[model samples]
Structure formats: C-alpha cells, structure tokens
Target: MASKRPQSPPISLVELRKRCRDASLSEQELTDYFLPDEENSKPFAPALKLNEALVDVGRARPGPDAISKLYADATRAQTPLPKKPRVLTQTFRRAAKTKLLAEGDSWFNLPDYIYPKTAIDFLGSDNDFDVSNIALWGDELEAMVRAKQYRQPLRSGLFGHFLFSGGGNDVLGSIPAYVKPRKSGDTDPAHAADYVKATFPQKISQMMGFYRSLANDARDATAGRVVLYVHGYANAIPKKGGHYLGGPFETLGFDPVAHAPLCRAIVAQMVKLFNDALQSFAQSTAHVVYNDLRPAMTERDWYRDEIHPNESGARKIARIFAESVRANTPGV
Candidate 1:
C-alpha cells in the first residue's frame, strides 16, 4: 500500500514536523498543509504568517544561516550607479544608487503560475533593477500596510526605490461585499462608475488611507530618500475562471458570460477608483510616484482566468516600470 497524502489542518503536529523536514515536499504542498483553504477566506493565504504547527515543530523562524542564504542571490551582482558630474561636491561624487525593494500582492509575489514569470521578475531581467522583494501572495493592501515587512529592508537609506504593487487584491476581494445588486429594471450601466454601490467610494477612501499611511512610513523610515513607485492594475474584463470571486459573482446572479457587460463595468469601476486614488496620492506625497498600468495590460496579456497577467503581459508592465526608473533615477 502507498503512504497516504498529508492533509492540511487537523493533521498531527508530528506529521507537520515530518513534512517540514521532508526535502521532497514541494512548496505548494507545504503551503497547503500549513495554510489550508478556508471557506470565504482571502484568495491567497498570507505566505509569511506564522503557523502554530511549525511553532510546535521547533522551527519558529528561518535560522540566520537560512535567511542569509535565501537573500544571497538577490543582494549579489548589483550594478552600482556611476559617479556624478565632476562639478558636484567631492563628498557626493559617487554615492551609490538607491537599492530597489518591492512589497505587495501576487503581482509581485506570484512566481509559480503556469509560466514561471511575474512582473517583478521581468523588471529585474528587462530593467536590471536589483530588487529585494518581500511581497506575499493573496496579501491585500490593508494587510500589506499593517504587516510592515519592508521596515527592516527600508532602513539605512539603502533602498531608494520602493516599488509597490497593491490595492488590486484588496479591491478584487471586496467586490462581492460592496457590489450593488442589479435592479429589476436596470439596463447595463453605460459607465463603469454606475455599477458600484454608493458605499464603494467610502470603501476606496478607507483603502487610500491605508496606502497613505504605508507611503508615509516608507518615506519616513528612509528619511525621505526613498522614492515610492506605486502601480495600479489594468482594467481586466471579468470572466468565470479565477481562483476566487467567481463563485461570489454567480451567487449574486451575475454570470461572467451572460452578464459580461455588467461584470466588466464593475471591474472598471473598481480599477478606476483604485488607480485614481493612487495617482492623486502620489501627486501630493513627496518622493511618491505613481505608475499607471492601465494602458500596459490588455485582455490578451491576462491568463485564461479573469485575474493575473500572462508572461508577455508581465513583460509589458515591467517595461513601464523601467521607464519610470529611467525618468526618476540615474546611473542604473
């Protein structure tokens, strides 16, 4: 007989430890065992969250040696910026270029999708930006702000460019909660704005507050040297096949196929609200720059599912960020 597959929760602590030590265990298997799918849970479980099973197994955190090994690749082979013009002061002649750091949702964290690619990965390859990314899959904007995983990396003014990709997961996750029901006599909304509930603006406002606070923290931590690069998602046409949100839509009586127009309208509204808030916030905040990704990705760029861009789409988005880097920073 074959050994039974390990289950998620409800498994014995002994089993959890055994699996953790098992070199053959794949990342997905470990993730599922540690962070099981819960009903109505957020699309992606917090990848970095501590689990009790591991705690009981005596592995509280990555040991220092492990941590060092993990980040070695990212820290190595960084290209230093060229010296400033001779006209500049001798003290500031050859200050190192600001390091790049990234934090946020799956857009920055998803590396194991069908094609082993992500926007951040593309940015590194296409733009030669050496970024130490701490983004986690399924992380919402509020969660990312509260997590503060970037704090340690942002210190010492080492990281000058803080690339962020958030708000998309937050808005997508909240769609079922705030989307208004289609009225009996309603026609397909002419504008995307018409599809959302009256409270959606307030919801967006609250999310903006999270973004603002996060930006402030990043800036303050680096003593205003770090320039934040915030990006918003493209207007993706809604469809039936995503990891999350599909069931909620059907439950609300909106079929992605039959109600394509309405679904797209809602997605548009969400995207607009998120992007507008980010752009406005960047305009007001010092050292904060917004990269509008709406034009970079089209339906063709996305995977078969409603959310997530394919490899080509990821490359296109990375090109936009490369432009932003060139415009803002020098000697890359």
Candidate 2:
C-alpha cells in the first residue's frame, strides 16, 4: 500500500532558491519531486545510525554483565526488534505481475503491502542486483528455483522452468511467497508440505532444491543452491558492511518491536520451509541462509526513532550479510 522507501525529506528551500537563481534548478527539477526522491535516493539516514550501534554491540565481550546488558537492552524501549506500525514494505511491480499475484495482494502475511510502481521518469534501476535487466519477477530469483506457468496478462503456458536461472535479481525483491500458517481450519497438519508439493515451489523452493543451477535462463534451468535473503522492515537491512559502522549496521530507521519480531517470525517460518524443501529433494543437499537485524538495532545510538538505523547502520548490516552469505552458503 505505502512505499517501503521513504519519500525524500523535502530539499532545503534555500538550496532550491539558489538553484533556481543560477539556473541550477535544472539539476533538481522534476514533476512530483517525490517520485525522483523515492526512485533515486538511498535511505542512508538509517545506515549511519546502525554504524554507531556496531560499536555498542562490539563492546559486549566474555562477561556476565556484558551478557546481561545485551539481553536487558533487547527488551528495552528503543530496540529495533519490533518495528512500529504501518511502515511500508517495498516490492517491485514487474516482478509482482510476472509472478501472477493478484492485484492488491502480497506474498507475506501482513498488510503494509509490497507494491512496486513502474516509475516511468525515474533513472537507474529498481533493483540493485541486475542493472542490465530493466525489469524482474519473483520467478527470476536465483536461489529458490521451481516450475512456472502463466496466461494472458500473466502467461498462458504449461508448467515452465525453475526460478532465478536467468541472472542476478535484487535479493530483497526476489522473494516470492513466504510460509504462512495454514489457517485455523487447515485440513491437514502437512498442509504446508502438500502445498509445496502440489503447487510450483516458490523462492524458498529454488533455494532448497536438490542442487544449484546458475544458468542464463530461469525457464530452462534445473535445481540449484540459492542464496535466499529474508527481509526485515523498512529499515530493510543491507547485505553488506562498512568499517567502524557505529551500530551493528549502517542504518537506524525501524521500530524494532514492530519490525524486527516480524522479520524473525518470518525467518522462523522460512526454516520450516527449508525443511520441507529438503524432503522434496529426497537426496537433500541444498543450502539456505538467514540474517537477523534485531540485535544491532537494539544496541545502537543513532536510533533516533527506535526503528531503522542510520546510513552507517545500514553499512553494518550489509557487511554482516556479506560475511554470513560467504560463510554458510555451502550448507543449509
């Protein structure tokens, strides 16, 4: 519904006046200025905050008080573990349509919906992973490969190829359907498993498939080892890190209790999905990865809003993510 990306805080009127006076306005000129800001600006404010938290978290060493402090802080007021209400989650439109998701629908359980608009006037790319490819879809994810089919606006074809055999996709955008509870009246205890079996396996499927497929076309690939990345909140943790990142990250922008807990809950379900995927392979040797953004968000300083980290904070998240992917990629 809302945008995961924050609209750019308005540009300083002084700067605008200066530009207009010198004809420099051309550089900053645009219709519905908010569009450009949303499309191009990086939410570095939170990244910077996380950078500071890295230092705070780094202080905890081998000691009882340190451990106590760490735990105490997690439950405190400023933690980013549970984000505040109604923050928007980002989603790419091309991918949503390609995935054949219904209008006004979402892949996750909550309602801050993921909807990516085409953004005609915007420059650069919607996704960071694939610059060459202008648009993307959930079926294009590299990690969780599986069968696909579409019709008309979506696709009217037979069961097609696996996911992400095509090329790089924004790790955050590639996620398709997450594992949601089967509802109170679910007919079967194995509903999640049966659903995975009967339907086309989603991203989680691609990641947990028997083998890793790094081909050039998604619709023509087989099973593969995927690098699955589950997203947190608007603080949308980065998958890389920077030096002296103040917090455990480079961002400080989420209400952790609202956002972090959801992320953890989502990830926990992901673990279960991985288990189901393992069973599907029969010979099971696929790998999966998960990263949490709560701890750092809890111990950071630039946590101005008790949510998303600052720019430096985001850097910390990215750094940690990069390392985790490197370390645990070979095994589930």
Candidate 3:
C-alpha cells in the first residue's frame, strides 16, 4: 500500500506569525508558543526575549484573545452613515435579492464617514439583503484567506455575492522599500511606472493565486451561484507621508517634501496595476466580475488620503458596485 501523504498543519502558522508581527498576540501566548515547556528543551530564544521586552514596554497584554477581540469590535463599529437626502445621493438604487459578504482590509473596515459605503452597503441598502462584513484594517490578500476571514462568514448562510477589496494594502505596505531616490527633474509618472513594471509581476501573481483559491472556496460553499466582485483603487494624491486618521509615516525615513511626488506616482501606478490584474482575473474566471471604480472616483473629490475614500467617495464607489451587480447578475 502507498504511504499516506503528510498531513497539513491544523492552523496557518503563517497567519500566527503575522499576528505576532502585528503585536496582536498576548505575552502569555507568545511565551507558551516560543519558549520550552520544562526549560531543558530548545526554545525560540529571540522571540522570548522580544516578548519579554514588549511586556516591559507595556505593549504585551494579559489575554491571548483580547487584542483580536478589540480588532473585531473596532471593525464592527463602522456603521453606515445615515442616508443622505435625495439631493446628496447620486447613485441609482436597485433592490437586491441576494445576501452580501465582504472581506478585505481598511477599505472595508474604516468608518463609513471616513471610508464611506463599502460595496456591501450598496448591495444591501434597498433590499431585504443581509450583509456580513469581516474586513479588517491592514489586511493583505493572502493573510485574509490564510486566516479564513472570508470562510467564517460563508458558514452563516448562502451569500449571493462576495465583494472583495484587497491588494492595495499589500502594494502600499511594500512599495516604500522598493522606491528609489529620484534624480533631479525626474518625472513622477515615469519613475512610478518603471517601479510598477519592475515590481508588479511577482506581487500580481501572488494576489491572483490567493483570489483563485478564494474563488474555489466560494464555488464549493455556494454551489457556483455566487458572484465575486473585485474592485480597483482610485488614484491618491498624498501631500505627505501620513495617514488621514492620524499617525505619521515619517518614521519610515522618507523626506516628506522630496518623496511626496514619487508617492503620488506610486499610487497612480498601483491603481493601474491592480485594475489590470483584476480585469485579467475576471476574464479567466467564471462568475467573477471586475468593477472599475477608478473612473468615477478619479473625477470626484472623495479621497480621505492617498488611499482611503471619504464618505462621499465611498457612496460613489458603492453606487458603481451596485449598478454593476444589477446589470450583471441574472434575476437580481
């Protein structure tokens, strides 16, 4: 008889490592995982030391689940802004027959006032549509799937649509490391385009793989009746290396004045690269639709920062998403 293949790990060690990097794990949990049980066995000494150091600095807390719970609570608190009067609303309304499930990063988790209507809000607004959003801030494409953030919601029931917003955080988080110092009078667009062409292939392939896996999972869970909607980001113009909500990216070591133009270039290039990948993915996959919100978003003054959208901006993107769904899905 042939030997059985090695069993896979029950939980994603990668996700666990990501949690540790984010400081989402408690001191005790880190100690239990990294340290030897009886002091005789080998331990991950560096991680133990780091854990101890974090505790000393009051960064490590008591409960292992506390930080994760806090994150979930924060995400849940992002309620939709009260519906504006007819004059303020610009998007067409269509009642939906299907439930909506959303997963991604801060684009979906940031408060409605700040990031505005997530795609789910648009799909669920007019119909008896139940919505479940499991998006978390700072989430990357692979991390969300590896952690099963999308899977948990699928268990609730059969959803008619799965709206995904990701890949932006992954690019934004990595690009600064790759951006080169600009030569005097170097055009921002050219430099940005070059950086994207050089870096996007590998990242795009990785993102495509994650999306493929997600598509497979959704098909299994929903019997191929669910529609997957992937979106592209709008161009962002950052005046400085700081987030809109608060927090400075100055610690990342870029000169705010010298690098600001390059940052804008990167944002524009990132949107194009992501949208291109999304369009290609949609072409290859069944029931996957790519919604290009960039055109509508670019013309409006909806951005909160370089990457996130304000409430008005969110409404515009949501409107586009809703219209796309109404047009694409049969019997919706």
RMSD of every prediction:
7.8, 20.8, 14.8
Residue range 1-332, candidate 1, lDDT tens digits: 99987654544445544544443445544444343223323543322222455335353454323322222222221223333324547676455333578887777765242233678877766435566677755667887788887776787456778888877756766667777666554547575466577787888798889888988899779888888899878777666744455556666677777777777778877888888988999899898989988788877898654567788888888888878876888653
Q: lDDT score of model 3?
A: 0.58
What tens-digit string does per-residue lDDT give for candidate 3 at 115-168? 345545555575645556666555677777777656645644556678888877
How much is 77 displaced in model 2, in angstroms? 38
Model 1 accuracy (lDDT, Cα): 0.65
Q: Please give, for residues 1-332, the per-residue lDDT of candidate 2 as tens digits.
A: 97674432344434433433443322123221211112221222111111121123244232332322222232221111111223334653223211101111011100001112211101112232111111222223322233322112122231111111121122222223323332343433233343232233465555533133322122232223223233232223222232111122223322223344433333334334444444344333233233444344433422333223444554555454444433643321
* Pick by TM-score: 1 or 3, better one: 1
User: If ranked by lDDT, best first, what sequence of candidates would result?
Assistant: 1, 3, 2
lDDT against the true structure, each candidate? 0.65, 0.28, 0.58
Q: Against the true structure, whose lDDT is highest?
A: 1
Q: List the residue pairs that clash in candidate 3.
A: none
The all-Cα superposition gives candidate 1 an RMSD in Å to the true structure of: 7.8
Error of 1 at 16 (Å): 9.2
